[model samples]
Target: MAHQVSASTLRRVLNIWPPFLFAGIRVRALSADYHHARVELRQHWYNRNFVGTHFGGSLFAMTDPFWMIMTMQALGSGYIVWDKAADIEFVKPGRGAVAAEFQLDDDVLALIRDATADGGKYLHWFATDVIDGEGDVVARIRKQVYVRRKPPRDGNG
Candidate 1:
C-alpha cells in the first residue's frame, strides 16, 4: 500500500487499471474533495452475459468500494472505515453503458462525525442507483459502512 493516491490521482489511475480497462469500466469523475464521483461501465463482449446484457458481477464491481472510499476520505485519518455489508438488486437488464453517481452530503458527514466522536462504532448505509444512458434505472446498490474514531494514545488506557 505504498501508493498513497489522492482522489484525482486515483480517478485517473483506476481508468487505466486492468480490471476496469478490460471490463470497460471508467471513472468518469472524482471530485477534488472526494465528496462525489461518477463511474460507468460499457457493455462490451467481455463484460456481457450470454443474453447480451451486462454481467451482474461487473455491475456490482463497478460500484464496489466507492462509498467506502468516499466515506473514508471524508472522515479523514483519525477514523477507521470499512465496508460492513452490501446488497444489490438488478432492477432491469443493462443493455448498454451504465453509470452511477456517488455523493457524500455535509449532513451525513456531520452525522458520522457526531456518532463517532466518542470513539464509538457506527454503521451507516448509503445507496446508489446504476442508470443507463437514457437515465433508466438498471440496478440499485446499498452498502453499509463501519466507522470508528481511533482511541487517544496518551497512555490513559
Candidate 2:
C-alpha cells in the first residue's frame, strides 16, 4: 500500500532523490493539490552536453516522474499508476537553465477516474515543455501513463 505523505515532505525527499540530485535537477515548486509543479535543471559542466548545452537526458529526467506520481496521488490507493512510455523532442539547444512545469487539470483527473472505474486500465498521454531562461522551448516531452483500478480486497471477517 502506498503511504500518504504531505506535499512538503515529498518535496524535501525529492530534492535529495539521487536521480534528480545527480542530474542537477531541482524541484522548485509543487502545489499542495499535486495538480501543479515546476522543476528546473541547471546547466553545469557535469550535466551539460559536449556543446555546452543542457544534456538531453537531464531535460527528460527533470519532468519524468511528475505525471505518474501526481496521478497516483490524485486517484488514491485504489488505483495503480505507472509510466508506460515516453518520447522527447529536442527543439533547440539549451544554453542555460531549463525548467518544466507540470499541470494536471481536474477535468483530466475526472476523466481518468471514470475511465478506470470498473477495474479497467487506461492509458493517458501528458506533455511538458522544457523551457530555457529566455522563455523559449528547449524540448518537448510526451509521456504515456498506465492507470488501473485494483480489485477489491476480501475482508477477513
Candidate 3:
C-alpha cells in the first residue's frame, strides 16, 4: 500500500472493536512522538475468572498488542516487527481496575535500529506490569520482539 497508518487511527480502530471494548479494555492515553501509551482494564463480569478473579486470558490479552505496535511506530518504515515470544508471571489476583503502560525510549530505539541496520534480525525485550487501582502489582509480563530490516524492493534475486 502507498498509504501510511497513523497511531491515532490504529487506536481508534482498536477502541471500537467489540472484543477489546467488551472486555473492559480502554486506552487512556497515547503519544505519537514518544510512542508511549496507557491502557486500563475495568472490573467487569466479562473479565472475571472462574474463581471470580480477573481472567488470566483477559490479563494476557490486555497486553498482547501494545509493545509490538509501539515498537513498529517508534521504528518507523522500512522495518519488520513481530512478537517473538512472551511469558507472564501472575503474582497476585487482579481484583479490580488494572492498568499497564507501554513505552519506547530513545535508548531502546537506538539499540533496535543499530542491531537491525545490517539487515539481520534482532531480538528486543520489554517488560510491563499490570497494576491494580491501589497501584499494587498484579502481574508481570515479559515480551520479546523480532525486528528485521526490510530488503530493498528491487525484485532481483
Candidate 4:
C-alpha cells in the first residue's frame, strides 16, 4: 500500500495540536509529497522562559518530529523508522519568531535506500538550523534515524 497521508493533511493536523498551537508552532510550508516542511515558533508568553526569552523546551519541540516523519513518508512502509538519537545546540536566545526547515532530497533518499537495501539496519543523520527572523542561527539540531526493511509477515525470519 502507498502512503495515504499528504503533507497538507499533516500540516493541518499539526496546526491544531497543543504542542504546535499553544506553543506557537506554525506549519508555514509543506511540500505536496512530504519531502520538505517548514515550521516556525513565534515568541509568546506561553513559550517564553522565566527570563522572557523563548523556552528551551519549546524551541526543541518546534524542531522535533519533522525528520523522522519525513523519512518515513519518503521511504514508505517497507522500512521501519525511529528517532535513534538527537542533540541541540543553542547558539542564541530566541527573542522572536524562529523557524526551521526540514528537507529530504533525492540524494538523501537514495543514500538511505542504498544503505538499507540489504535489510540491514542503517543510520542516517540529518541536521537543520533553527534561525530567528533575521536568519541568525539560534540553534542547531542533529537527528539520527534508524531505518531497516521490515521482515516478511509470514513468520519468516
Candidate 5:
C-alpha cells in the first residue's frame, strides 16, 4: 500500500465521507486487520422515502465500500481490487437502525490468491444482509469484486 493507515483511522474517514455522512451511514466497527466491518444506517427525514422507510439507495450505500476495501487491505499492495458490479434486493421496509456486517474469511482470501496467481483476474461475489433493529433482514446486497495480481514493475523512473 502506498499509504498505510490504521483500520480505526480508515473507519473515521469513511464515516465522514459525504455520501455516507449525508445518507446517515455510519461505520460502527472496523477490525485492526480489516477482515471484518460493521456499518449502520439510521432512519432520518433526509434519508427516508415517500413510504416513510429507509431509502433504497441509502441502504445499498451502507454496504457499498466494505468488501472492496477490506479485500484490498487483506491482500495488500501486491494485488488490485475493484468493485465490478452490485445488486441489492429490498426484502423488507427498513426502520430505526439497520446494520450490515462484512467478514472476509481465510478460505475466501486463499481462493482469491490462488485464482489470481496466474496473472489473471478473479471475480468473487460477496454478500451482505442489512438487518433492522429487531434483527429482521431489510435488504440483501451482493457485490462483485475483481482481483488481479499486479504485474512486476519495470524500473524506468
Candidate 6:
C-alpha cells in the first residue's frame, strides 16, 4: 500500500519549493481529498517581464505539476503517474495576482480507472485557465499526463 500524504503537508512543501517560491507562486488551497487545488502567482519585479507583466514562464510554472499530482494521489499506489507534456498560451498580460484552479471529478477518475485497467499506459489531457484578480483569463494551459497500472509483484516474500 502507498503511504498517504495529506493536503496540508503538500501545500506547505510546495509553497516553499524553490521554483514556486522564486516565481512567487503559492498554493493557496488544496482539498483534503486532493481533488481540488488553487494556485496563485503574484507579480513582482523579479517575476515581471520587460513590459512589467507577469512572465509567461512564471504563469506556466504556476500551473505545472497540478494535474499529475491530482491524478497520482487519486489513483494511489496501484498506478504510475507522470507529467507527459504541456503547452501554455498567453491569453492576456497578467498585471497582478493570477490564479488557477484544478479539479478532478469522479467521472474523470472513473474514466482513468477504466482506461488503465488493462495495465497499459494511458495519456490523458487536462486543461486549466489562469485568471487575473478580476477573473479574466490570463493564460490557458494544457497538460498531458501518463498513467499505468503496476504489474503484479512476485510472491517471493
RMSD list, candidates in order:
2.1, 1.1, 2.1, 2.3, 1.3, 1.5
lDDT of 4 by residue, 6-44 (tens): 888888999998888988899998898778899998887
Clashes of each: 0, 0, 0, 0, 0, 0
Instruction: Give the Cα error of residue 16 in candidate 4, in Å.
Output: 0.8
Please state the error at residue 104 of candidate 1 in Å: 0.6
State every prediction's TM-score relative to the real structure: 0.93, 0.96, 0.92, 0.93, 0.96, 0.96
- What is the TM-score of candidate 3? 0.92
Reference-based TM-score, model 5: 0.96
Write one digit per residue (lDDT tens) for candidate 3, span 1-157.
1124776777788788887888888877778663788888988887898889999877888888888888887777788889999999998999989999987789998999899889999998899999998889999999999999888899777
Clashes of 4: 0
State how far residue 144 of model 2 sits from its true place (Å). Answer: 0.6
Off by over 4 Å in 4: 1-3, 153-157
Regions more than 4 Å wrong, model 3: 1-3, 155-157
Q: Find the candidate with the highest lDDT and give its number.
A: 5
In the predicted model 2, the residue pairs found to clash are: none
Model 1 residue runs over 4 Å out of place are 1-4, 155-157
lDDT per residue for candidate 6 within 1-157, as digits (tens), equals 4456988999999999999999999999999888999999988899999999999999999999889988899888889899999999888899988999999998998999999999998999999999999999999999999999999898886
4 or 6, greater by lDDT: 6
lDDT: which is higher, 1 or 4? 1
Model 1 agreement with the true structure over 1-157: per-residue lDDT tens digits: 1223598888988889888888899999998777999999989889999899999989988999888888888777888889999999999999888999998999999999999999899999999999999999999999999999977789876
